[model samples]
Target: MQVHIRYFSVYGSTQTYAEHLAGLLNTSAHPLEVPLPDDATPVIALSPVHGPVVQAATYARKIQGRPVAVAAVGMTLLDVAREKDSLRKLVPEHVARFYLPGKLEFSTMSTAHRATLASISTMLRAKPVKSANDKAMIAAMGTDTDRMDFAELQPIVQWVQSLR
Candidate 1:
């Protein structure tokens, strides 16, 4: 089966995941800004935590009515996806979505992301989650980095392959 993994990544983790997934499947992935080929290849829309904002949804719509998958990477609570009503609606039916842990360097993220998070934290009357794990994650998220263990893609890859 032919597959097209098209993705948008603000911090690059999603793109890195897509590339690794494509390599494992022995198929090429596409850039989010590019046009998907007209041929009948199943499209996978991948994105980072920015969610529907990154136009992964718009890209998915271009290949709508075809078999497609949507996967997102983010700093998630273990069952965040299951609990999030908004995320449920954002991920389309033909789209198989999953989340992997994402770490963001305070310095590397766009000012908009940092500001938004800061605002959201303040509005919620909470400080950023200051767990030991969180601290380690952030410290490792050096400037100019979007590092992730490719193993996170395995479950989704196996599931997608099963669809063939």
Candidate 2:
């Protein structure tokens, strides 16, 4: 079985993972904007997570009824149950899900995104009791923190290989 890799990336982290995963699978990665060659091919759609939203939800919906896996890239630390629960609301329950840590590059973000993050940071800072994750997010607001590790993609690679 041949698997196709498609990615929707705003800040490039998803694309990075997509390409690496493609390499591991001996396939090339294509942007989600490019239509898949066929409906029968299994797809691994990767997208960046913006809070509760998964950017590739629309694409995943369009590719329904085939074998599909969604890899959500975000800056937050892993909480499998939380992440999976968040993803279930956006992606169909039948779609397989995975989470990978992504980089936070303020410089690469658009003005609107930057402003939104600033607003969230302000809100989190105002909380009287903040969790460690909240504090980490606040600290990471303006800095470029690279949390992308190629080794983190091993699980994805294994999943793709299983298709064979």
Candidate 3:
């Protein structure tokens, strides 16, 4: 079976996971910006979950007719059920889904993200009340934090192996 891996990462955690997976699968992982190959092969896509949304879902329409599997990486925790629900809009129901935790380096964020994080931090710090999510985000306001683990990739590996 032919496998094509496409991924996008901001801080490189997802890219790391993608590379590791590609290494094991013995396939090359390309950036999502590159065009999907012309043949109908299984596609393994890795993208960071920004707001629990797959950032690379925008590529779904371009990859129709190919079997697909997705891995969503994020600093925030999420369950597979929610991910499945969100992923249905992006891929067919036959598409497999996986979630992996990723790190967020405050210094490595883009300007727009940094500005947004700063605003949220300021609001949460100034306000007497904060929601659980807000509190979590506030508590995580620091540089060089990591949650990614290589062992977390077993599900993805199993999915790919099943395909093979």
Report lDDT per candidate. 0.66, 0.82, 0.77
lDDT for residue 22 in candidate 3, whole number 0-100: 86
Question: What TM-score, to 2 decimals, does candidate 1 have?
Answer: 0.76
What lDDT score is found at residue 109 in candidate 2?
A: 83
Q: Is candidate 2 or candidate 3 better by TM-score?
A: 2
Shift of residue 70 alpha carbon in model 1, Å: 0.2
Give lDDT tens digits, candidate 3, residues 105-151. 97778888878777868987888887665666678886666878888
Among these predictions, the greatest TM-score belongs to: 2
Instruction: Tell me the tens digit of each residue's lDDT in model 2 across 77-118.
Output: 766434445677777788877888889898888999999999
Of candidates 3 and 2, the better by lDDT: 2
lDDT of 1 by residue, 46-97 (tens): 7776634535665665575567776767754435543563445665566666
What would the TM-scores of all predictions be? 0.76, 0.90, 0.80
**In model 2, what lDDT does residue 21 have?**
90
Error in Å for residue 159 of model 2? 1.8
- Top candidate on lDDT is 2
In order of TM-score, best first, we have 2, 3, 1
Q: Compute the lDDT of residue 47 as modeled in candidate 3.
A: 91
Candidate 2 — what's its lDDT? Answer: 0.82
